[model samples]
Target: MTRIGFRLALAYRSNIIMTCVALVAQVFLLRMIWTSVYGSRPAAAGLTLDALLAYLTLANLQAFVTHTIVSRIIHDRIRTGMVFFDLARPVGYLRQMAGFQAGNTLGGLLLLAPVIPVVLLVGSITVPVNGAGYVITLVLGYVIAVQLALLISLIGFWTMEIGAVSLLYRLVSQFFAGTMVPLAFFPGFLGVVAEILPFKYMGYVPAAVYVGHISDISGPVVVELAWIAGLWGLLVLTWSRAHRRVVIQGG
Candidate 1:
């Protein structure tokens, strides 16, 4: 499944190119915005201009790498009745999806080879404060990302068409996940909301750890582990329900 996903990702050469182009453009655009905002000020919210730029660059790259289209896959399969074949397989549906997503992530990593240098030229990014801790949390972040995507995808088992729901989820999750801005910059109730949500662990925590915004990863790592356990349990329950609710449309 992983090999299949890698091949499938590479098969769409145009998509990979366009996505990289878009991400590069986005990085530059955001850099300009942040530069203007800083406007000679050294730092805001404990983030210096350089640190903020690095955060933006790394966060965007991480977001791109971890992004998944599992919901779309699930929706299409369910719509076409191909999902029935997935159900009949010996492997657990969630495991199959995870394997494919892992491969897709590896493919994204390969595509990043060219983009990384471009971003690096744009600005300086800091080395990880805790190399080992950064790696552990980043991997944990990927798992949380996949689990969240799978949970959202499972909604298609009942709704049949999850385009709107999936879009909304992406928008909300990205915003709260610190893909756009760091949760540290979020004010008042919004910051509180982001803190309580699992989304932060996906993008923010990992990038923060890399940028030194998070010096002690012990707490965040613990929270991430707890979220993983909790989410997996929820996924199991949801999949069981979705399994029974499957309705084949046009086979």
Candidate 2:
């Protein structure tokens, strides 16, 4: 299944390239925005300007790396009655979806190689304080992201199409996941709210860990693992219910 997904991802090379370009442009724009905002202040909200850039850069990469194409793919399958074929297959539906996401993430990381240099040159990307922990947290962040996307995709079982809901998911995730602005920038109450939500594990936590904003990694790691377990349970429950209710219409 992973091999199949890898091949499928290879077919989307052009899309990956475009994504890299867009991410690079985003890094550039963010660099400008944050630089202007900092404007000689050494630090704000416990993050130096360099730390902020590192956070944004890593957050964007997390966003891109964890992006799931399965929602669109599954939506089309459902609409065309092809999802039934998947259901009939011997492979576990959840495992197949996860394998595909893993493969796609590998492809995204490959594409990221080019963008990293640009970000490094312009954004002043820095090494994480806890290099090993950062790597681990980074991988966990991508896993959390994939799980979130899968949950959104599974909604297609009821909606039969995810176009509108997918857009809504992206917007909500972007804000709550701290891609728009660091959670540190949020007011006290909102920051607390964000911390409790799983979205923070998707980007903010890992980015903070990378930039040394989070000194003790155990707390965030434990919370993130708990969220991952919670999300997995939700996915299992939702998929079980949706699979039973599925009634392919029109095709």
Best-fitting candidate, scored by TM-score: 1
What are the models' TM-scores? 0.95, 0.94
Tens-place lDDT digits, model 1, residues 148-167: 99999998877778899999
True lDDT of residue 230, candidate 2: 88
As a whole number from 0 to 100, the lDDT of residue 68 in candidate 2 is: 77
Clashing pairs in model 2?
none
Would you give me the overall lDDT of model 2? 0.82
- Per residue, candidate 2 scores C-alpha lDDT tens digits across 1-251 of 67767777778889888888888889889989999999999999999888999899888877777677877777888888887888888997888888877876776677677777886767688767878888878777778888888888888887777899999988888788898799999998988888777787778888888889888989878877887898899999988888777643322
Look at candidate 2 and tell me the lDDT of residue 157.
81
Predicted structure with the largest lDDT when compared to the true one: 1
Q: What TM-score should be assigned to candidate 2? A: 0.94
Clashes of 2: 0
